[model samples]
Target: MLYDLFWQPFADFAFMRHALVGCLALALGCAPIGLFLVLRRMSLMGDAMSHAILPGAAIAFIAFGLSLTAMSLGGLLAGLVVVLAAGAVTRSTQLKEDASFAAFYLVSLASGVLLVSKWGNNVDLMHILFGSVLAVDDMALCFLAGVASITVLTLAVLYRALVVESFDPEFLRATGGGGAWAHFGFLILVVLNLVAGFQALGTLMAVGLMMLPAASARLWARELPAMLAIALGIALLSAYIGLLLSYHADLPSGPAIILTAGLAYFASLGLGRHGGLLGRWLRGRHLEA
Candidate 1:
């Protein structure tokens, strides 16, 4: 039964294949970064940065028409600028990271909306906001593959510095390595993944793709390496299940994928053995008797 449903979609429709492949690439690229973002308490930063891409995307569309490659590059640059500026503002002022992020994201979102309205072309707005995974073409797929490869390679090469800087920047500095550079590099990776993902997931939910699986994994794992593995597994599973659901239900792929990740998060919260609601409830019952 299951094979019958998925076989037609996979074999007959090129769009279905594109969507599945694109989502898988997003999963792999996002999982590790998501885990680190959670560890560094920068999950909100990821969210902020995702939304900050909207203005850039709108401007790119206005200037050069609906060119996916150009818009992706423009969005990437905008996200990077916002994140860097937020970091600088936080370091130089008394405002917290979350505060800076919230402020910037709101401003960017409003500006993006206004720009799109001023351009007087409302045709592609839906694509920018909600995403159109079924519209993925060969060029977009190639771009996604390249971005994913670069992101993975950079993370592998900088793994040690990233780990040290994430867990203990002071110790990394004491060991004669500059933690700031590592942080900057990690932020760049985050921007790249966000841009790559935007093509399928849109700016609104791009950060959710990066965050939910990793957050779910944290509920079950105690160590960073284990958490990373679990996060990756969860991300992949969510992508597969989400794609199937979207195919069957005729729903939007991005939201379906995000909802699948959210379901995993809730399952982890409720049933995980380490510190879930069920675990706490069982312990309480045993103690009461």
Candidate 2:
């Protein structure tokens, strides 16, 4: 029965195929970035940036009249601007990083919503909020693919510096690598991923995909590489399974995908041997004897 439901749709429909491929691409691109974000304790920054893209998207719609390419580019630029501005503010002022991020994103979010409301295009807001993967066209797919490739390549080249800076910026500075710029570059890549993911996952949950699997991987792995590999594996698995479920169950693709990733996170929290709650409980019981 399950095979009939799943295989028949893929065999018969084009949209399902697009959704599956698109989601997989998103997972591959976003998961590794998620690992670094989690390690750097900047998960909330992802959330802020996701919301911050709204106004840019809204303005793009108003100015360019619903050109997806224009809107996406505009939103991407907005996200990068916010990231840089946040950094500048944090460095030049007394505000902490989190405080700066919160202020910038909240203001951006509110401005976007207000502008969209004023422009009388509330319908587009749904697309900005929840996404519609089934609506993805060949152009969007190609764009996502390019963004994914660039994101993965950038991360690969900068992996060592990012890892070092994440763990110990002082050590990196001592080694004369200019850890600050490296850190800045890493965040720029993250902002790009968040922008790319906005189309597939939307503002409400784009960062969810970027954070949950990496968070889950942390339960079992101590080293950064192992954690990243495990996170990527879990993310890919979630996308495949979630797409299948969405196909058979006729659910919204993005949220279904996110829920699948969330389940993996919860399972890891419970069953992981390193620090999982279940593992700890079992060890305690065993030691009581």
Candidate 3:
């Protein structure tokens, strides 16, 4: 029963195998990016970029009729534009970054919805918004793999600079470091991963995969390296169990994976050793004793 429920789906179906591979790749790529976002309090920024890519993807679909390369490039350009515009709006105007991000993402979301409605069919829109993981082709797989490789290597190369910039941008700059470059590089990685994630999880929920595991890890781990490692493990486990559930229970794969991550986050909230609800309660009881 266990094999039938868990292993058979993947073993029997090529699509299932492909989906598993894609989710694993997403976990590998997005988890680290997510840890940084959580640490920097930019979880919402990841969500914004996910949504911001939608209009560009929609435009690409309209122009090229579902060409993966075009849509990916368009999404990348759109994310970059939103990042730049939001930064400019925050720095040049009096608006805060969050407010500017909100403005930009909302506008992008509306534009995407309108474009999809006007130029595309429900099938196309559904695929873009909710994703069709079972339909992942060779091209999509290559794209996802490339993004994962790039994200991992880039994070490794700039690990120290990113850490310093995240914690002390002012200090980094004062010490004659390229904090701005690190920030931009990190944002670019975020965008790239979001685009890759959109292929499997869709625009609406791609950031969920990134943020949820990272947030859960935050509750359980104290150090950055521990958090990153824990986040990656949680993400991979979520993907594995989520795929099984999606197969046996007939759930949406993307949402299933994301909801599994959510469960981990909530579980960590209660049971994590670092600062969990149970941990704090136990400490309190010990103090009273």
Candidate 4:
């Protein structure tokens, strides 16, 4: 029964094996970026970038006829454009950061939808919007693995600068610490991971894998390193269980994974030891006594 429940599907199908490997790579690569997004209160920013990248991929598909490299480059450029334009607007105008991001992404999303509608069939559109993880090819797997490797190495190299910028940007800048470069570098990493994730989970769901696990971990871990570790672990668990649920329940793979992460988030919200509702209520009751 245990083997049937857990190992049978993967053993019987190559696609399941590939999906598991892809999820593992994503959990390792995207979770840390999601942790930083939560810590810096930039969850919405990730969402906006995810949406913004769609138009680029759409254009690439329209022009190059489903070339993965073209679409990835297009998506990367679109994400970077949105980040730069939003950041510039936030710094130069009275518009706040989130508002600026919202403006750009809304425009990008609309444009992407229009482009997809005009140039591609519904199947192509669905592939871009929801991904085809079950149909992942060797090239896609290689790309995913490469992105994960690069992300992990880059984060390790820039850990201290990113930590300082997250908690104390003013201090980092005042100390001549190249905070702007660090910030740009971080944003680039976010874009890269999103582009990589887009191939597996679609743009709409990619950010969920990153943010949901990070948010859930935030409820439990007080320290940065702990939060990153917990978030990665939660993400990996969610990916595995989500795949199992997808196979058994006949659910959409991407959303099943995201919903699993959402489940973890809600569970953390209520039962977490550090900042959960139960913890708060317990402290309140103690105070009353």
lDDT of 2 by residue, 226-289 (tens): 9988999898888778877887788888899899999999999999867899999999999997
- For model 4, residues 127-166, the per-residue Cα lDDT tens digits are 8998877777777788889999999999998899999988
Q: List lDDT for all candidates, in order.
A: 0.87, 0.84, 0.91, 0.92
In angstroms, the error of model 1 at 244 is 1.3
Minimum summed lDDT over a 10-residue window in model 3 is located at 130-139
lDDT of 2: 0.84
Flag clash pairs in model 2. Answer: none
Best by lDDT: 4
Q: Tell me, what's the RMSD of every candidate?
A: 1.4, 1.5, 1.1, 1.1
Candidate order by lDDT, highest to lowest? 4, 3, 1, 2
TM-score, predicted candidate 4 vs. hidden true structure = 0.97
The weakest ten consecutive residues by lDDT in model 4 span 131-140
lDDT by residue (1-289, candidate 3, tens digit) is 8788779999999999999998899899999999999888888988889999999999998999888899999899999999999989999999999899999999999999899999888888888998877778888888888999999999999899888887888899999788888888999999999999989989988998899999999998889999999999999999999998888889989899999999999999999988899999999999999
Error of 1 at 123 (Å): 4.3
Question: Which residue pairs in candidate 4 have backbone atoms (N, alpha carbon, C) closer than 3 angstroms, thus clashing?
Answer: none
- Clash count for candidate 4 is 0
TM-scores, one per candidate:
0.95, 0.95, 0.97, 0.97
Candidate 3: residue pairs that collide: none
- The 10-residue segment with the lowest total lDDT in model 2: 2-11
